[model samples]
Target chain A: MSQEKSLLNKLVFSLQCLPGVGRKSAQRMAYHLLDKDREGALRLANDLKSAMDEIGNCERCRDYTEASLCEICRNEKRNEQTLCVVESPADVAAIESTGSYTGKYFVLMGNLSPLDGIGPDEIGLNQLKTLVEQTDCQEIIVATSATVEGEATAHFISTIVQGVKDKQVSVSRLAQGVPIGGELEYLDSSTLALSLANRQSI
Target chain B: MSQEKSLLNKLVFSLQCLPGVGRKSAQRMAYHLLDKDREGALRLANDLKSAMDEIGNCERCRDYTEASLCEICRNEKRNEQTLCVVESPADVAAIESTGSYTGKYFVLMGNLSPLDGIGPDEIGLNQLKTLVEQTDCQEIIVATSATVEGEATAHFISTIVQGVKDKQVSVSRLAQGVPIGGELEYLDSSTLALSLANRQSI
Candidate 1:
């Protein structure tokens, strides 16, 4: 009985490594894996191992890829001149799913957090700077996030782009305002103020 | 990009098999497996496969086991004369975790859901009957559930026990009332009424 309990506990503990999963959820997942969908769990495990082993940062954009370069970075049709810089691979996926962006991406993998010891080198800001300097991209889109750290990272990146000699590169950010289909009544005061301040001409 | 997207989609779809995990959660899980806890994911997969292959119904009880008999059934210290009947392996696990019951158990694996084509044979009621008749158990605790179906199954089992010629076996159920520390205001009318009707004398 104790041995089986230990086994269950171990499985539950392992499941807790996932984002947002608490003890209850983990236990439920463990029981489910043991009882019902063991095959699915096995497949997921195999995928995780293979993905971890094979997927590396793309040579150009630093996104996850099984090869030297990601499919997006290798594609000649995508606008290399218009690069969107994001905080992580998940962000890259988010943008791609929207189907609105046809340009390339540069994944920082993390944001700059001095307190957490995540600095320029740690987040691959140096690599981004080098890429900006070398590439023929005339525009750099700093789409990090909306938080203070995100704004700070964007400012740092813009400064880097401005310092590059000879080539003229324009840096921009994602607009902060009311989201599409967002109701005014439900919006926070700060966001409402920002939306009013940055009001667009219809 | 499409190929990579499909791979991610496959992983996401697989993750959706977990209870309470929707598309958004599945995607998040997939990314977490890829970006952070690949090793954990791999281990989970291995455990899933091994558990599926090895775990089976215990001969004495229908609860999940790696051997012919579950640990609880094999344990000589437990009360063999008292058998608790439950609807699922999870129910057995729940009772075991409580550390209160030291008796044997018979897991039905499911309740009698006639609409879903589940009947006596489907839930191994015949097997349960045989075990009850054959064993020297003085008491049979029907702890299936508190639902309508659960009550019906318990009634059916009681009828079967009455039909047995020799030794008299006592049938019992889990008490239904306002849970410990439950507020009267929060409890449903039916439960509150039940608690009142079945009140214990101080």
Candidate 2:
């Protein structure tokens, strides 16, 4: 009984540590590991460890990558003149899955939220402005979220772009209601594609 | 962006390995890991490896354990004169969580399924008979599952117990209406307990 408890405890302790996973779910996972896919579970463990050890953020756009530049950033065909700014790689994947937009991107990585104390500096707003000024980008689209923080970050970027380059970069927001609060990944591919295509000037 | 992808991939991959988890849930978990519990994620990775490396079956009952004798077998207070036989530790736990029944257990580890090529030998039914014959146990309870295989295993145990032991070893079964398709691990504590208390003679 003590040995059984110890085995179960070890599994439960580890499983509960997963993000948002409570005790019950953790137990289910542990049982699943024992009953179903032992090898798959091992792979998952290895995948987790290796991914954490090896993967990093893109220096230019703040998108996820296994190398110095994300695949999109490294792509030569993507337009260098027009840049799309998004909050996360999932957003980038949302845009890319469309196969419609050929424009380049500058990822802000996050939005500005004064309440959360996540300011422009925190989300790399300064880097965004610098990239806009340094590049010959004619249009800079603010693809940040539609949330309050997203709105603030977009406006902040617009203002900073104007101040730095003294040039009017075509700043745009995603068409209204296209995005909910949390994620761009959950959006249907077609909707995300449409949102990118019908993007209007802000 | 590369670095972010590396870390996020681990989180996403790890989460997707959980039962009923999809890409959508994986992304949510990834965000939670980065935003709310980075340290927790690391702990999960480490603990998963450790549990897989350290935990195994109890030598006696074949229930998951970290030692030779399971807790039920080791505890001195538990009745040595009575033995309850079960399919798995999950079953043992279902019984134990109720805080009912003072008898010790003998876990078979699995049911008899001819399709899966799991026979009496596979579940160590002979070993159970040997243990019962050798021990001072006055009563042997067949608390295996209620499925077809479980019934078959129970009959086998009863037949073996009858042939080996000169004294009549009482054979009982946990009651039915436990949601036929349901697993022991998922039953509510009280319901599981009711099933145990109302168990009938086989």
Candidate 3:
């Protein structure tokens, strides 16, 4: 009756449901999947289903994991005394690929955003503090983004962890690994810049 | 041991899995999806799933249908004596969008690609012959692609469908709405050559 077009037009209409996708790209992706990669196109469907079914945050560090602990947390080779904290599971994955940081990671899952009503509890800050106290961690490197929320989160964690015991836990942020206000996740998709950019004594 | 970049990287990789989508376009698509519309991305994923689920070939005409008969085959007003054969459901959708055609349709599902181990049976040519023999189809339109496989298929189908005795089936083709060596699915998505070119009478 009213002609925006057919179901195909309506079908291609919702290309923006995927993260980091848009109108033209959505159309391109829809056409691409429907037109050529029938099997791979089906894979996208499977991915969404699997992600909905299996993807969950690590209960301990709040990173995406299929099990209770992510592969990083399960690894016994990592130094339990030195723990690196970051904003997202993606960030943890980025750090792990460098092979330089043998220390374990604690993912924040989200930064402090009071306006969005995202607080310490929502992002598992309590779990992080518990992990720090339970483990033999002497130093906690806060590698949250340099944004206001990231800075605020790191500052909050440092003050709390510092006040916990007479053990005098060391609290430090990443030493210029990120440009001001730039998310660490957006850095180039290569091992080179990620490792080279990571500095000592953060 | 590889860096996990932005959601954009996942987007590009996801889009690259689509048919005929190149890396640059995939990147462009990712930026577009991330920048403007996220719902479109999910819609594409959902669309692929729905189309895969609901759209199937008609039992009689081999046209796309959510039921045994497509809208055209179910329509009492449609010309039952004329059948237009195409290589895919996209072709049927394309023609139906014009609102000009009032005939039935038969979809091959694919062209005959023997090298890839695809044959007439795989693409449902035998069923098409059966449809032609049973129905009082006076005119048959062969609208297969002009590609090597498409031509071979059209030739094969024309031979089988026209060879049936008793009924006078005038087998013609649609040279008007299509271009030479062109794929129907890409007709709308791809760049055009000012392509207001009208069909010359065959």
Question: Which stretches of candidate 2 lie above 4 Å from their native place?
Answer: A1-4, A177-202, B1-15, B34-36, B176-202
How would the docking of model 1 be graded? Answer: medium
DockQ of each: 0.52, 0.40, 0.19
Stretches of model 3 off by over 4 angstroms after superposition: A1-17, A20-55, A69-71, A74-76, A146-152, A163-165, A175-202, B1-57, B63-67, B155-168, B176-202
Q: DockQ for model 1? A: 0.52
Q: Considering every candidate listed, which one attains the maximal DockQ?
A: 1
List model 1 lDDT by residue over A1-202, tens digit each.
Answer: 3564445556677777778889888878877876678777777766656665676778877887777888898788998899999998889888988999999999988888999999998878788888888888899999999999999999999998888888899999998999899999999999999989998999
RMSD of each: 1.9, 6.6, 8.6
By lDDT, the candidates rank as 1, 2, 3
Could you give me the TM-score of model 1 versus the true structure? 0.94
Which scores greater on TM-score, model 1 or model 3? 1
TM-score of every model? 0.94, 0.80, 0.63
Q: Calculate the i-RMS of every candidate, to one decimal place.
A: 2.3, 3.6, 5.7
1 or 2: which has the higher lDDT?
1
lDDT of 2 at A175: 64
